[model samples]
Target chain A: ARPRVGYYFTGKTGSQVLTDKIKKLQVKDFQSIPVVVAENVSVYDAIVTMFLEDVGTLFVVDQGSILVGVLSRKDLLRTSIGKQELSTIPVNIIMTRMPNITMCEREDSLIDVAQKLIEKQIDALPVVKLTEKGIEVIGRITKTNMTKALVSLAIDGLV
Target chain B: ARPRVGYYFTGKTGSQVLTDKIKKLQVKDFQSIPVVVAENVSVYDAIVTMFLEDVGTLFVVDQGSILVGVLSRKDLLRTSIGKQELSTIPVNIIMTRMPNITMCEREDSLIDVAQKLIEKQIDALPVVKLTEKGIEVIGRITKTNMTKALVSLAIDGLV
Candidate 1:
């Protein structure tokens, strides 16, 4: 018998979000800001931008601004040392492209979110919501916030 | 006000543990397995392990078997050429040690896991879990698995 989709479909709610579960815990939370860059960014400028931002990565986006690939410090450094100089290289030239990016729906459970992280070998996921046009990027999730919550929850969910 | 802890605690399921979460997905699932080695293992052996395992990096574990460091495939090979001879050297001689290691708990949300992988400038995660004895080692998460899972899930979930 086919399993019912209704059984698996979850309601997007605060209680379902792992953050809310851990919100009361007194600890650092993972911020939602994800550094983004244009897909055609020159390698030289991208590296400078990353350094300026003090972040190790940038999200390459389309003109519509949805995430298309990930440009890491290492990726930029590697491409820079190669024959192609910054001007000749596009962000897409060495970027870790998608659908290689791990992503989640706003409705996903923190447990489900964590599972995806471990299973995906990724450090960040772009949270999105379903819309008539397509999957729309919305927020980000971090491991630190999840950990603080998890520790509290593991202690019998003590607040 | 404190919420009720009784209903909040997620109990042990026994099977499909946090370790299982790390191992269940292959790179084919777009996840990466963090490869590892013993502290006493020669850099030569570490190289061989890297090739055989097809992993780009490895973790170094201590006498009690707790993870102590990370060694990229490139770092191991580059440092091994003149830094230490396999005949008398140990991975600990050159491996980047912990708490330098970018690690995550079994319960961390995937969003954070992905961020750590990207931010840490490394390719894998050693999922750890607390046991009655102490914090014990679990399976690895890798970049290959992360990408593979991304490709697979993108197709499976979206298309």
Candidate 2:
């Protein structure tokens, strides 16, 4: 029979156990609905969609809904202030393209994704699924989600 | 003498210990340097300042460095797409003015600020000090800082 005591023996310190629990958190568990824009959409329309969706970053998709690029508020703001008209400019020309976009899988650890965001200095990452055609944007994870994760841990121990 | 065992006897459980540690994290420990722009600066200059500073939010202040308003990338983007000239329009015309802004103090708990960020649907908060003159911007706390806190907790157990 186990001993009844104030502390339960788990072969790990309290902080170590806590670290393990947080490290196991997966991106799928906290990801948000991904807001996407078609590659051919004008920068103007994309901005409108961002406002309507109330998202900071947008995933750009091709006609087949294949991930092609990523658009951030900074990207749009830069173009908006440029000499060119926003409505006339397509998003593909200004967006961070596929090879340059940082992405993650739904099953990836939230900690790893957080590190990526910090290392890349990006605001968000698309939770993606690789298929026969191309990568599909299944969800979105941003610092907002990370902040919520912290709050949940403090409030509920992430149980 | 304390018992030598796999788990030392503490009144709190592992999760409770972790929760208490995180709940006690202060804004001053994780805050970033605030980037501010004069209220009289043009929207164009503000955008440039945001890019140069590499921050998503900028604090708006008066000549005496008293905080008067807040500017977010979303706020700037909306104004950028407007028909009006960016360079000619001042930031005060579009900023989220005082009394409507969400703020925090350096001594405030990080968890509380994270909750406020989620509740208000805002990305950043100005860490302010109330002086005889008015509010002064001392630091900036954003989702980025919260994310960093989460990462630190995982990597170092916040030790």
The numbered model that scores best in DockQ is 2
Relative to the true structure, how large is the alpha-carbon lDDT of every model? 0.56, 0.94
What lDDT, from 0 to 1, does candidate 1 have? 0.56
Candidates in order, interface RMSD in Å: 10.6, 0.5
DockQ scores for all predicted structures? 0.07, 0.91
The regions of model 2 sitting more than 4 angstroms off are A1-8, B1-8
Tens-place lDDT per residue, model 2, A2-111, is: 68754456678778988999999999999999999999999999999999999999999999999999999999999999999899999999999968899999999999
Candidate 2 per-residue lDDT over residues B72-152, each given as its tens digit? 999999999999999999999999997899999999999999999999999999999999989999999999999999999
- B1-159: candidate 1 lDDT, tens digit per residue: 545643322343312232233333332223344566788988767777866775556778776767777787546534533424465777888888766766666555554565566666565777776666644557676554443333232233211
- C-alpha displacement of B119 in model 2, angstroms? 0.9
